[model samples]
Target: MTDTLLTPGAHLFQAVEAALAGGCRWVQYRDKSGDHERRAREAQQLLDLCEQAGARLIINDDLALALRVEAHGVHLGQGDGDPAEARRLLGPTAILGVTCHDSLPLARQAVVNGASYVAFGRFFPSRTKPEASPAPLSLLREARAALPNTPLVAIGGITLDNAHTLIAAGADTLAVSHSLFGADAIEARARTFTTLFNQHSST
Candidate 1:
C-alpha cells in the first residue's frame, strides 16, 4: 500500500491553502479546545478547502462536528469516542483514526475496534502539547513488526531534522503539527517536509 502522509495543524485558511500548495495529500484540523460554534465553522471551511484541493480532511477529537460538516474522517484519542462506536455512528465508509500512544496492545485493540489507522507519538520533544506521553522509536519498530498492513502514524515532535529516522524506524505516516504550519510561510515548510518525506519513501 502507498504510504499516507498527513500535514495537520493549520489554524488558518491561508495556512491550510498554503499546505495544499505544497502537495499535502491529507490534512487534519486538530484544535484541542475551542468554542463549539467557532470549531464547527472552521471545520466547515476546512472541509470546503480540502474538497477543492482534493485532499482529505480529518477532524481531531470532534466526531459530531466532523459528521455535521461531512468531513472525510475523524481522529480520536483514548479520551474520545470508542472506534467501534465511531464506526457505528459514521458507518462503513467513514474513515476513523485512533490514538494509541505507546501501547501495542491498545493499537491491536483499536484495529479490532474498527480504527482505520493507529497513531502513536511524542517520539521527540513537542512544543505543541508537551504533556503528551513521550513514546520511543522502539514503539514504532514493534508496531511495524506486529501490524505490517495497518497504517501506523507517528506524531509529536516530528520535524525535518528527525523525520528520516522515524521513517527508518517504520512509521507509515508522519503526523506533524508545528513543524509545518507553525511558521510564516506554510507552503515552504510543508514543501520542505513533503520533500524529505518523498526522499525517505524513495529510499
Candidate 2:
C-alpha cells in the first residue's frame, strides 16, 4: 500500500518535480474549472514531469485531457463522467478512479464499471473544496471487509499526524494535498509521510 499526494495550487512544474524528487510515487494533477486549453497544457506538463520522475500521474475530472496526454490514469467524481463511457474511450490499459465518498454501493458500482480504484474522503477538516459528505474511519473498515480485493483510497485532510489512524482503519492509500505542500520543508515533510507509510505497512 502507498500514500498518494495530489499537487497543490502552485507552479505546476515546480510542484510536480518537487513531489517526485521527494519520493511521491503517484501524483494526481488536479485543477478544477480552468479553461480547456490551459488545463490540457498543464496536464501535459505534469505528465512530462511524471514521466521523467518515474511516477504515475492521474488527471482529475477531464477524460478528454487525459486521453490527449495519454496520462497514467483519470479520476472522476460522481457527476464528472460515466465510468463505462470513460472505459470505452480510454481503452483497456488506462487506469480509472471514481470518487465513492462514503458509499459502498457507489464503490461497488465503480468497480463493476471498470474503475481501477475507489476514493473516499474528507475524513478530517477540508479547506480545499466544499465536500458534500464526510466519511468516517469505520467506512474504510467496512469497505475493506466487503471489497477485500479492491484498492481503497482515503482522501481529504490527511496528514502525517493522523495517517496511521487511517491506515489502521484499512485505508490502502491516503490521498493528500494541503498538508504536504503547506509545510516549510516540503521534502522533509514528504519524507516523514514516506516513513509513516513504511511504518504503517510494517504494522
Candidate 3:
C-alpha cells in the first residue's frame, strides 16, 4: 500500500505516481491531516491516477471519502469504523480491509464481518508509526492457518531488505509507506518490492 505520510510532506502525488510507474497494482491513499476539502480533492486525483494506471485505490480510515472518491476499497483501523457497516456502505464488491494488529481473533472477526483482507503490522521498526502495535512473523503464519482464503497484508516498516520474510511467512501484501516514498528514489524502491514479490511468487 502507498501512503502519503508525515515526512514525505509535499511530494504525495509524486509518491503515488512513483508507485504506479513501478507497476504497482494497488495504492492506498492514507492521509490523516483532517483537511476535508484538500483530502477530497487529493483522493479524487489519486482515483484518477489509479484508474489510468489500472491500480486499485484503497482509502484509509475514511468511509465517506472512499465512497466520495469512488475508491476501490477502504482499509479500516481499530478506531476507524465498524467493518460490517463499512461493508454495507461500500457494497458487496467494494474491498474492505481491516487492521488486525497481532490478534488472530480480531482478524477472524474482521473476516466474519466481511473484511476482504486483514492487515498485521509493525514487524520492523517504523518511522511513520514508531509507536505502532508490534506483530510477529509467526502471526502471519497463524493468520494464514486461521484465514486461509483471506488476503493478508503486512504493514509498518516493511522494506526490500526484510519483506521476503513476511512473504515467506504468508503475507500476501506488504503494506509499505515511508520505506518506499520517503526515499528520493521512490520508483526504484517500489520496484525492489515488486521484484521481491515477483521473485517470491515464482519460487
Candidate 4:
C-alpha cells in the first residue's frame, strides 16, 4: 500500500508535486480557506496533476468542488455534510473517507454510511489543529480489531520521530500536513514517510 498521505495546506501545489515525486499515491486537498472560486481552480489543477501521476486526489470537505473537479473523492469531517450524500454525488467509483476522531461508533457509522476509509486522531500535538483532541494508540489497536477490512488513517503531528508507533499500533496511512510540507526538503520528508510504509510492508 502506498501509505504516505500528503494533505495540502498553505503551499498547495508545491506540497502535492513534492509528495507525488516521493512516490505518494494519495493527496488530499485540505483547503479551509473558503474561497470557492480559488479552491475550485486549484482542485481542477490538482486533478490534472494527480491523473498524470496515477495518484488519487481527495478534496477536503466541499462536495460540490469535488464533483466539479471530478476528483477521486471527498473527505468528510464531523459536520461536513452527509457521507451518504457525498457518496451519491461522487458515485460508487469514487473514494469516500471520513474522520472518526478516535470513536469506534463513529468509524462504524461512517462505514455504514458508505465511507471508503476511516481516519482517527490528533495523535500528537498538531501544528494544524493544536486544540484537536488527542487520540490514543489504543484507539487504533481497537479500531483495527473492530474494522478489519477497512483501512485506518492516523493523523495530526505525525513526524518521522513518532510515525513508527502509529504504524505499529495499526495505522495503515498517516495523514500529515505541515510536518511534511513545511520542511526545507519536502520531497525528502515525504520519502521518509514512504520509506516507513515500505519497511512496514516488507516486514
lDDT of 4 by residue, 1-203 (tens): 11223334445676678788887888888767768897788888888878989999998877888988888998988889999888887899999999898689999999998999999998999877687789999999999999999999998888999999999999999998877777788788889899999998899
TM-score for candidate 2: 0.91
- Model 3: what TM-score? 0.95
Best lDDT goes to which candidate?
A: 3
Which residue window of length 10 is worst by lDDT in model 1? Answer: 1-10
What TM-score goes with each of the models? Answer: 0.91, 0.91, 0.95, 0.93
Kindly report which residue stretches of model 4 are placed more than 4 angstroms away from their true locations once superposed: 1-11
**Worst 10-residue lDDT window, candidate 4:** 1-10
- Given candidate 4, what's the lDDT at residue 77? 89
Tens digits of per-residue lDDT for model 3 on 73-175?
9999999999999999999999999998889999999999999999998899987778888999999999999889999999888877899999999999988
lDDT of each: 0.82, 0.80, 0.87, 0.84
Off by over 4 Å in 1: 1-11
Residues 1-203 of candidate 1: C-alpha lDDT, one tens digit per residue: 01112333343777788888888878888776557887788789888888998999998888998889999889998999878999888888888999998799999999999888999987888876578898989999999999888898898888888998888899878887777776677788888877877887787
- List model 2 lDDT by residue over 76-178, tens digit each: 9999999999998998888899999889999999999999889998788876645558889999999999899988999888888889899899887778778
lDDT of 4: 0.84
